[model samples]
Target: MTTSDIDESVRAELDRLRSSIDNIDAAVVHMLAERFKCTQQVGHLKAQHHLPPADPAREARQIARLRQLAESAKLDPAFAEKLLNFIIAEVIRHHEQIADQPGERP
Candidate 1:
């Protein structure tokens, strides 16, 4: 193929890959939002029960479960662990914020 033709092919493939990534990003954002919502509810429940804000043991369990799932899916366990850790941290922080707010019960 001519140089221009090869360049066009590569560009097309890159565009396709980008589109897929965009979809994945959207899904991740949606799932994170859902996670935060659930965590907020949990925070409320914990507040009502007069429990502490952080649940280190539960968080560790969740990380372990996520790591297992990633392994089963044939993905990189380390990458999965890191990503889940980040997400979990964010969720926990949001939960704590919700719990600490004066007006809210959780």
Candidate 2:
């Protein structure tokens, strides 16, 4: 193939890869939203039971699992850990917000 043809082929491949990544990004965002909704539910449950907003053990277990999955997926484990830490922090904040509202459960 000519040089220009090779370049065109590579560009087509990149475009295809980018489209796949975009789709994955959308799904990831949707999954995160669903997770946040579950966090809100947990906040309500905790408030009702007079439990603490943060669950250290649960968070630890979650991080551990994520790290293992990251390793298996050939991804950066540290990045996965950091990401999960950030997510857990957000969950804590959401829980605290719900807790602060009047008549909110545990």
Candidate 3:
């Protein structure tokens, strides 16, 4: 094939790969939204029960479990841990907010 034809072929493949990545990104956002919705309810319950916003034991277990999963999937364990930490931080923030609201007691 000519050089110009090879360049066009490469561009086409890259575009296809990018399109798949975009779709995966959208799926990840939607999944996170769903997960946060569930966590919101948990936060409200915790607030009513006067439980602490952060659970260190659960967080530790989750980090370890996710790291294992990432390794098994051939992805970077550190990256997975960072992502989970970010999500956990947001969840704790929401829980704290719930706890601060008045009339949370049962």
Q: Which ten residues in a row have the lowest lDDT in candidate 3?
A: 1-10
Q: Which ten residues in a row have the lowest lDDT in candidate 1?
A: 97-106
Top lDDT hit: 3
Ranking by TM-score: 3, 2, 1
Cα lDDT tens digits for candidate 2, 25-102: 999999999999998999999888888899999999999999999999999999999999999999999889888889
- Model 3, span 6-93: residue lDDT tens: 7877989988999999999999999999999999999999999889999999999999999999999999999999999999999999
Please list the residue runs of candidate 2 whose C-alpha ends up more than 4 Å from where it truly belongs after superposition.
1-6
Model 1 lDDT tens row, 1-106: 6656677779899889999999999998898788778887888888767777778898889888988999999998889989978877777677677778886663
What's the lDDT for candidate 3? Answer: 0.95
Q: Which predicted model would earn the best TM-score? A: 3
Rank the candidate models, highest lDDT first: 3, 2, 1
Candidate 3 accuracy as TM-score: 0.90
Q: For model 1, which pairs clash?
A: 44-106, 99-106
Alpha carbon lDDT of residue 90, candidate 1? 78
Which regions of candidate 3 fall more than 4 Å away from where they truly are? Answer: 1-6
